[model samples]
Target: MIETPGILLTILSFMLVIGPLVFVHEMGHYLAGRIFGIKADAFAIGFGREIAGFTDRRGTRWKFGWLPLGGYVKFAGDMTPASEPSAEWLALPAEERQRTFQSKPVWQRAIVVAAGPVVNFVVAIVILAGFALAYGDVRMPPVIGATVPGSAAALAGLQQGDRVTALGGRSVETFDDMARYARIRAGERTRIDVLRDGRLVSRDVVIGTELQRDRFGNEYRIGRLGIAGGKPIVVRVGLLEAPAVAVKRTGEIVSMMVETLGQVISGRRSVKELGGPLSIAKVSGEQMSLGLDAYVFLIALVSINLGFINLLPVPMLDGGHLLFYAIEAVRRKPVGPDVQEWAYRGGLAAILALMLLVTFNDLGNFGLWKNLAGLIG
Candidate 1:
């Protein structure tokens, strides 16, 4: 049976988690544009027909849309959601044009476009840093307590009490570090370095893969070295050091994301494993039920994902705008409107197709497809 959080709670949690992130993302663009004296026409929390709004003293209309999917900041002289320039607005008098986004220099335009995703990363770092400040760090040594029989480690001749020093040419300091390294190297031949009885030993092994199910019955395929940690150690973090720790944690998470994408592209993983807004809602509800701490951690994770996705070089995304800016910087002029319009259309179609695919995956995960098939039969 498919178990899920109550529908009411799911909707509430989805809004609670997504709304602020969207606001923060758009706010990044707004602030960056303001810095360059670019006037915003509107700052909206969502798309489509506005539900409620007010014009700020600066003449920027602040509005909330009925749909809670995503948001945008409409700057003066922007003709499309992609933030393409409008020729009519660009043709305004010098005094009037000075306050429009198209009037800004290319460098300023790049920063304004990049600020949205960059702010998402900054927000993620802040949330993660808060956790580090509160919980401290685990200082587990990379000592192998035992190896599973017939598993990759044992098959490679790994033994108990071996102090793991490195994996795949990278230094591994602690058990957690080794686990992290192993998690990404599944099914790959790797060189593992260890100190065996005070002597250096190296083993070449093909890391094993495992399909594991969580309490929620969610299946995940992960890498495994089949070796357990020796013991536990924990250390408190200083106030000055927590941010640095969080930064490192953020970098690791980004690395994992990049690796996962590479795995998917290389056909080592399936695209069906990808999640969408529906998945976000389900996970949000589940995490919220776990507790506030769990929910907050989810927020940080989703923040990083949002930042990373926006940085992709797909049209209609922040990175696409930056790509255009880079081209303009090189060509000494902006791309033609006809070319930009076609690119935006392609981007929108790609985004929609992806949404449909992930939504299909979500339904499969919820067993909805099976249920419908049973009914039809």
Candidate 2:
């Protein structure tokens, strides 16, 4: 069983990782609202009972809530759960409703809604750049450091110290590139070009396959090349190049997220592979055990995930709100409140169901459920 200290550490780690990400996301909305002359009634850091709060000079109540799950920005004249204003708001005196979100121009409203997710992306980019600049980028070159005995690479006469110059005629610059190529070509015959002992060599390699588990406890066959690469070597970059590195890193993260999501949706990956807060806590705790760099990298990766997920066009998410704004922009009118209300209700249900599913997977992955089942058995 995980100890008390371990559980507490996991909880604290979850808060640390999630709190700032949530804050940055909400701040994007708050700042954009203010910029568009919309009055924000409250800017909260969490949900549920307010633990502490103070009203700013601008009349925005800044508060820290007891529940650390999520937060929101309550706009002026928002009558229905602090989202876009309702028709009742429009019926109010012109001056009184002026600051209402729905009263703003469509473009401004879109900006305000889109800002939240955009801020998440921005935060991810900044964090990536900062880490890259401070620690220098460390990555493995496309060189084979080791090969498992009897593995495909070994069987194909591939040996340690062989640099993979190309795979299937595609130039491989990094180990990751080679891995991706191998994964995509799994179970297929492929030609490889290697530099061995300063001599160019060619070989036919068949990618191996193995079962992999996702965070959701779902398993799938993933292509594997039975070769390991050396540890990443730090590559320093100039100040001017830091931002470029950050952008590149962010793009790579986004691409990975897209691929993962596509695989999940296509049933190539299991739904059990999804993770929730529990899984994140576990990962954070594990990273804490590794050291400061590992912890920071984990946090950055989570931040990127948070940002990318919010950008997904699902109801009750930031991206969903942005989608509504897009429709409003094109139609020159807001979506009907009834339509929005129904959509929100459905979205909330779907999100809650997903949360429960992911939570179940997390418990199973952590052996909590299995232990309980064992006791029953």
Top candidate on lDDT is: 1
Write down the TM-score for model 2.
Answer: 0.82
Candidate 1 regions exceeding 4 Å error are 1-3, 68-70, 81-85, 184-186, 197-199
Residue 236 of model 2, lDDT score: 97
* TM-score winner: 1
Give the runs in model 2 whose Cα sits over 4 Å from its true position: 1-5, 68-70, 81-87, 139-149, 154-173, 180-223, 228-233
- CA displacement after TM-score superposition, residue 92 of candidate 2 (Å): 3.0
Q: Rate the local accuracy (lDDT) of all candidates.
A: 0.88, 0.81
TM-score of every candidate? 0.93, 0.82
